[model samples]
Target: MRYEETAQLENPRSSVSTDMMVGTALYTLAIGVFFVVFGLRKRQRWIVFWGATMVVAGAAYVVAIALGVDK
Candidate 1:
């Protein structure tokens, strides 16, 4: 592709709607919650750690979207 054309390429994130982003983030949060719960029940520390990370990331994403900082 030409340099100009590449430079003009659209950002995939720019095309995503707020609703879709929120939905995805919410889904991530749900998965995280599930992992945390399941890990606790299974006595698995790693699973809980990953789940907490996911929860933090999802929450951050939601906050970023709300604050209009995603752009």
Candidate 2:
């Protein structure tokens, strides 16, 4: 039997581009907004909470990218 090992880099380069990241962030923000609105209409507190969490995360991701945190 032969054993194979996977090597991991200390500082791996990200293949995701700025445009792709922005697009992903925007999509997440949109979904969060949808969840928040739907939850409000349905009066679901848990859903609202989760939606708000997603909103914050999406916004933070955008801010982080803008600040060059990815680098």
Candidate 3:
């Protein structure tokens, strides 16, 4: 029987890009707005909470990007 070893690959380059970060922020904001609209239309408290959470998360992402923490 032969034993084989697997090597792990790592990316030394930074994974963050200005365009990608901005796009993600915009996407998250859109999703938050959608959730808010859905919650209002459905009159669901849980949906509203989720929507608020999404907004906060999106804001945090934006801040992280601005701070260059993605690197």
- Quote each prediction's TM-score: 0.72, 0.72, 0.61
Q: Which clashing pairs does model 3 show?
A: none
lDDT of 3 at 15: 80
lDDT of 3 at 62: 86
**True lDDT of residue 37, candidate 2:** 96
Kindly report which residue stretches of model 2 are placed more than 4 angstroms away from their true locations once superposed.
1-15
lDDT values for all models? 0.90, 0.90, 0.84
lDDT (Cα, tens digit) per residue for candidate 3, span 1-71: 98798785786565887787788887887898889889999999888888888888888888888898978
- lDDT-superior candidate, 1 or 3: 1
Candidate 2 per-residue lDDT, tens place, 1-71, comes to 98898898997887987889889888888899999999999999988998898899899999999899988
lDDT per residue (tens digit) for residues 1-71 in model 1: 65554455474545777798799999999999999999999999999999998999999999988898967
